[model samples]
Target: MFTTTAGKPLRYNHWRKSYFDSAVSAAGLADVTPHDLRAPHGTWVADRYGVMTAAHRLGTRTRA
Candidate 1:
């Protein structure tokens, strides 16, 4: 959840280009996108909690 200095939600494109990219570049990470972080987060959640919890956290539906 990122917000602007004005306390408004940051637009995805603007945040990606202006903030995310610059931070990633400064950290020396190459070819990474915001969506790329989701997998590792999901994996960590699933491992620590469970698949259902991870799915819930990720807003994904589980099959019955």
Candidate 2:
């Protein structure tokens, strides 16, 4: 069990590195990090869904 900043027991940070590394290896990619996923996910959702949705999910304002 892991504890958050608020002291709630949760499954956290256990497999984060392993999972990220596996994805990078499987995709034959380089220097990929969790932050890297944010850009593509935001871009895809903005493209397929809408700019507002993507910006909301990414917690950012859309720009022209």
TM-scores, each model vs. reference: 0.76, 0.64
Among residues 3 or more apart in sequence or in different chains, the pairs in candidate 1 whose N, CA or C atoms overlap within 3 Å are none
Question: Candidate 1's residue-wise lDDT over 1-64, tens digit each?
Answer: 7799999998999989998999999999999999999999999999999999999999998886
Q: Which stretches of candidate 1 lie over 4 Å from their true place?
A: none
Poorly placed runs, candidate 2 (over 4 Å): 1-13, 61-64
* Residue 4 of model 1, lDDT score: 93
Which candidate has the highest lDDT of all? 1
C-alpha lDDT of candidate 1 relative to the true structure: 0.94
Q: Give the TM-score of candidate 2.
A: 0.64
